[model samples]
Target chain A: MRSYRTSTVVALGLGLALLGTSAFAEAAKDITLLTWLGGPDRKVLDTLVTGFQAKHPDYKVKINVVTSQGDARGGMRTALMGGEKPDLVTNTWPAFRKELADAGILRDVTPVWTSKGWDKSLAKTWRDISTTGGSVYGIPYIFGYRSGIWYVPADLQKIGLQAFPTSYDDFLATFDPLRKAGFAEPIAMPAKVYAHSEWFETLLMRTGGPGLVTDLGAHKIAWTDPKVAEALRQYARLFGAKCCGDSKLMYATHWDDAADRIFVERKANFLQIGMWINARAISQYHLKPGTDYSLGKFPALGRGFDNASIIDAKEILATGIGSNPDGADAFLDYVLSADGANIIAKAGFTTPSSSVDASIYDPVAAASVRFVNEGDVRFVLGDLLPGSLVDEYRLALQQFIGNPTEANIAPTLERIEAAAARAY
Target chain B: MSAVDTRLPPPGARAAHRGSPGPAPGRRAWMPESATALLLLTPVILLFGLSVIYPVIETLRISFWEIRGLGRPRFVGFDNYLRLFSDPVFLGTLWTTLIFTVGVTIVAVTIGWTIALLCAFAPRQTSIFRLMIFATFGISEAVAGYIWIGIFRPGDAGLLNGMLSAIGLADLAQPWLGGANSALIALIITAAWSAVGLPLLLSFASVQAIPRSILEAAYMDGAKPLAMMWHIMVPLSLPGARVAIFLTLLSSLRAFDIVFVLTAGGPARATETVGFFMYRESMTQFNLGYGAAATIILLIGVLLVSTPAIAQRTKGAK
Candidate 1:
């Protein structure tokens, strides 16, 4: 009789232990966030996750960081297709949103936005970029000003150039003397397609005018337009110049590596980059912002749109279709909220939401914001164009840069036109 | 014993001579030997059907449809193929692939064969030399690509260009991976560097398998080093050499990651091969149907490239 009594008590204890363990497992809901952010940018995300977990003690956030955008896109696509969706994923702005929506991998967050009234806080352009076919698939976390050219004023002084060139012709002319002064490449350019397209689109916006570039990105304008061809020709000429560096080295160098040339090694006088470069400068080059360097505008080409800036709003974070979407939506809501935008702003990212206080931004980011706000803003052409056309543009531009001659210009344009025709 | 002829014969002899026909009182009915073998092979057959056969058939089906991402595919019979045939870029890519495959196969086989001959005939340090030559096989293709980038990198930082400058041949330092033909040449060298190991290992094994008596007889007949290699070792090792060349050709035809990491089919699509084109169309562009069509075309090209080697190997075997 004593043995039986002991067994009953032990059974009760085991049952209580099992129940407590299950309750503990249910307390902290695991939410996975996938992104391609690295360096200081990754730290910013980690801090945001910590803030979110602190605010919502019942939810635990897991971060999955990929090193490159291409890998991130492919990985997310596979995961969604394989039925293992990440709770939240940060993707390339408009392009990935369109692709994911078409694949039905993205959750419709329009209702979420309307419920929270978060759509009202976003810049109209950013809100429009996130919505496709009447559904909000993503929210802008950061906007990279692609028009900024990083230059050391001292380097320009050594090359006998007193000021940055504001006009296209003047910019082209500066290359010769800079080369003569033994600055073989006045500008450090990465051969990467995305990097190339940033400058290409900037040139297109300044030379072909924003209207035509917008039309071209939307497949409304033919790629063979004489104005478009002119832009390509101009871009080819600049790329082939002595100041653009050796085609071999430029083609082989990565975008981040090329940025390092100006920021750390001082190998080149200027680097065509954006606001995110500051993050890289601080993290990798150990350089101070504003004091170490400053931002300049892309040279104007007199196409009726002066002071226009190129913007890449590629980091659009959103909830995916799977388990813990409510939790994911809650996190994105926090990220896009005024408080969340403040966290992002303090971390040196340019938040698209106006609700966030702007004073937390560093001088370089503040300058970018002021320049973009004061001037006309346009999206990167590659971001707006379909994938096939983007690929064709890269191929055409790279080929033209490879052998930039007057004779090659016509064929390159024709080839690009042929590709554009098939995009739709 | 004659009266008890109902007794079974020796156990082994009885089993070898006759099969069981009916069920014993306590057991189930006997199955035929062939039927049992088929039953045993069922799991492998099912796995092959699920993994390999189903995908190939699905790809063929999808080749006739237009797929934009995971959306419902619309059947577009023969259109993708027609587009492929008419695509100037795809045609250019095909030409590039041909050059890449033929070039890598010929170069890798020749070099591997030459090295194998040296390893076979050398009287001293054969194992050490063999180890040194075969060490490259241990490196991955991606790593091999990065290693070659240092050599082929443009400008003063590059090993090749720096060496040229150091030797007063600075004028010859041009971007090895930037020009039209130059990019293709650089890719071929990288691919050969990655692929040569297999052929070397195989040819070495083949050379070792060659009966020493035949080589000695050739030596007795006054065969010199070159003559013996050309007349004796190579002819005897043709079978292994054929396999090595075929594998190299196959790998080169589908080469994607190396070109992707190295040139990305750039300097004006100068190095764009069919494999890279397919990846761009399918993964990058989300045009799975079009990519499927390109994949089928590449498969056919591979089959055409490998058919001769296979036939030769078969004839040799017979």
Candidate 2:
């Protein structure tokens, strides 16, 4: 009886001591951030929080995660509509940012941009892309190169090519020899939902340049525009080259399955995707970058838009409803600082801020940064379209992949046009 | 029917079957039976109105508006419904939902009823097998969907394709979920496999409820096993089968999770049902009015499927 009483007292004392210490160590002010990022991306956010808390000992970040699958936009909208007044939110979709801004959910940070001298670190292009209706709303901290083709160096060697193809014709020419070398389909096209559009989107940039992508995404140019049809024709050219497997196989494959075909199975030679494939290849397949595999920019189509690039960026947007505006502003500034940018680079993502050193990134990510610097970059087209139009556009694209002939291109473009008519 | 009931009932038992009492007019203040019954059910009535009735009314109200993506809703009256009827995607979903519901019901009920009849012959011997089959009913549809994804996955990595190659039938192996018809078929097969467990248990209970005396009489009359089963067990066990059909039809009409996990209403929306269409509209596109209209349509479908069975049961009770 005596021992039991003593143990209970000791347990209560320890609990109180731990609670008191935590209470004392707590920061005086806090700002909340809402996001749907998980896995390695979540870890990156945790690291940023640590670095920020250390710098601003009196301020803290409280992260509210909205758990979701597939598209995170739906979950974010639900959280906001359900009355979650987060101070900041990590966003990627320009159209989504526009929606939030139109709904009075986002705050214009142009004043912060001018006062904090953010133009020295971020380029004009980042600011321009982050702006909606002449008001800037977010800070783009990390970006991924979307136009690169992921391939094993050895697969190209199998067909006796010392390097990846440099032109569109040369790239298509490798399929026959690659087939002869026991690779049935040189490219694993994942049309299960969306990844197959990566090829077509880049081809659009190649054929019509970034301006056409911008115009078509905003429906300023109808989907039936000649430039759009010509881009689809260019997309059809890859199918004419016998580049992928049957329509059924493509329709059944997802991005992860295609990644397996490239890395684990080695049954295919190339996959066009964003920079997340680099992390996936390194961690999941345990392959080293630049040694076992490397990224190649999409082959030049020899159009006037040969230098254009397509990319996706993760941006932090300020909200209009939070109480801790100061804490949120300080966090945004720190994200662009040298320390924050380096932490991002260390986590295997490329940062847009000039403060980040190129040496901190892995070879693949470094190449992506170099490629972005070498071209005019546009956000990935799918992320720029409204929600209503985007679904219809992808579904129409799916139908086109089923039969990628010249005859099918016009009808496909018309289908997307019909949806865009109602979207706006 | 009257052979076993010739004995007389004692005292109050005779009058008990006829009436409790017409009215308590001669007694002290008394409450009517109907009124007393309603009083007893008040809590349940209120609970039902709160839990089930209010949300349905709210949904119907929302279906009349034009609510789009957190935007201010304008009352559009019947425009959303009119749009749904004309929309090719929604029309396609109705057709797909019909085919999916019918396909799942036919496949599940047939297999379950057949297996249950066979299991009735030796319940003790097949106890483990019956348990295993019924256990599948307890599995979550989402988990079952992922398991089928591995089986139906494209290329040689998939189990079905691998088995085909092992059997020297490699030419027959195709992407089961890639084509339109094939994906719908695969979805039906998965839904039926998941749904069969319930019908099996229900039909088996009904079969077990068959009186032993009848089976013995049929056997003593030199009836064959198949004959006794066809003539005796089939008709007697139909009430359970009817209930199972009503239930399976209701569930299959609202099928979403399996389709979501399996095909996601893809390959150009070939396998999309009304439930998935509702989700895509409401949750994904944030078209609350349009999605609510779809839900109300699905609810009507469920009522149509269930009304016949319910009417027949109600008539029997009367």
Candidate 3:
């Protein structure tokens, strides 16, 4: 009888030990995160992950850095389709987010959002974009003002400009003195798809405010609107006046090359690009922001319209179909917490929904914040379009830049509209 | 007739008497000798089925559907085909691919043939030259692309442009890769440069194996250098030239890596070939069904154009 009782006790002890070890193993799960965070951005993300791991001490986060934006979106789609999805993914464009939601790869984060009371921390516009079908699907990570121009400080000082222009007339007037002072080209305009689109979008916003692009993206307004046509005409006039470099040269060049010419060669006094371009310039050329160069909102078009621009949030990390829901929820909470936001902000990057103090930023970020707070900035137009329509627009822009004409513009716009209609 | 019948019966009986007479010499010659041959061939046949035949069949099957790498494939019949006709980018890529193929094939084969001839006829120093030229074949296509990119970069900091400027030819410093008109040409040059060494080495080996007696006899007959090259050497080396040209043509038709790394079908799609377009559709856009359709189109094009040349070369070789 004693032997039997001891045997039973031993069996129970073994079972309990096995269960405890399995639980510990389950708690130490490794999660894969797909992101485009490399270089300095990668270092920053690694620090944040380290912090999270220190607090949890049970989970392991493995990050796979995708080299390009295109690859990240395409790879995620392929992975989800193959049922080999990552635990978390970062996507830049809203179209991708919508596509993932439509495909049911994204977990509905509404409950998590509500449980965590994340709504109290996020802006309404950001929250609206993150929600689909009245349910939250994604969280915004980093945000930047897209429609802006960079100018060399020396050029601005030489031209007797005290500060960046706040209105369109003053913007053109500043260029006139630069042109008269023997600066053959005052701006370096790349005829790339995104570059040209940004130029046109900035011009439209300056002329008619952010409503024009927003309406166009929402299909409430046509591309052949009179304001758009006038904007195109103005773009052509600027091209003819040599206010920008050769369109063909620009079309053939990458954005980085254009940035290099502005920053290194001093061939052009100004360049219009996104904040990511600023990051690239600073990293590549070792230039000090606000000292060697300065940032300004894209020049305004007319008096009635306020200084307006476009804002684009970088991709957010979200749970995929194959993720451990509980662990993913924990990570999401960590990301939304004040600690995570502070870590990202201190690394010289901006989080979309985070309430970061502007005083801590460099001059460019501070200026970008001022513009976002004051100007009527809308979301990027292409990001708002359907994926198919975005591709169509990119192709159309390429074609237009290759052979820009009054005769070609209408047909190109018509083709794009037809494509957009079909997509919808 | 009576005598012949008698002899045939006698011969059959004699062969039966000679211990099966090596199992009828004709059968022995027709069949492979050992099980090892079949064993070795099995893996090759299986690989051919899996890599070559299966993908072709799967691509054709998927071309008829509306599959986009995600979800179930929906049969769309002729819609995908109809869309191909209407796709302006596809049309443009087709033309560009054709131009690139013809241009690269002609350049590579001609240059390779010339180098082969030099290696065959030139002095001992020509061996060094041959080795140097053949060394390029050892380099990967990606490395070749980067080397050419460094050479053809448009800025004043570029190697070629800087050299030209130093030589007081600053006026000649044009954007070699910065315009639609020049981008394709630049890509073709890089492709030809990267591909020349393979054909050159192959042709050189074939030329070296040519009977020296034939060449000596030609020399004895007072054949001039050009006459020997054009008439005697070329006709004899036709087999090698044929193989070289066929390889060059195929490589140029399917050229992807160099163009991908260097131009990526850019400069207003001037360098966009069918291969690059298919890659973008499948890999970049995640439009697998469309990519499959494009791939099917490319396979058909290659087969239709190349089969005849390959067959003719094989027949000539035999």
Best by DockQ: 2
Model 1 per-residue lDDT tens digits across residues A228-323:
778777787786566587667677666765776666656776777677778877787787777777777777788777677778774545555556
Ordered list by lDDT, greatest first: 2, 1, 3
Cα lDDT tens digits for candidate 2, A296-326: 9899989888777899999999999887777
Q: What is the C-alpha lDDT of each candidate?
A: 0.77, 0.90, 0.73
Better of 1 and 3 by lDDT: 1
Alpha carbon lDDT of residue B184, candidate 1?
Answer: 90
Candidate 2 segments exceeding 4 Å error: A1-28, B1-47
Q: DockQ of every model listed?
A: 0.28, 0.48, 0.34
CAPRI-style quality class for the chain A–B interface of candidate 1: acceptable
* lDDT against true structure, model 1: 0.77
Alpha-carbon RMSD to native, per candidate: 5.6, 7.1, 5.5
TM-scores, chain B, all models: 0.86, 0.89, 0.84
Model 3, runs deviating above 4 Å = A1-30, A36-41, A64-71, A174-184, A218-220, A303-307, A353-360, A402-408, B1-38, B68-72, B121-128, B216-228, B231-235, B313-318
Worst 10 residues of 2 chain A by lDDT: A21-30
> Which candidate should be chosen as best, given lDDT against the real structure?
2
Residue-level lDDT tens digits of model 3 in A36-78: 6677677766877887788777788888765553445666665
Positional deviation of residue A253's Cα in model 2 after best superposition, in angstroms: 1.3
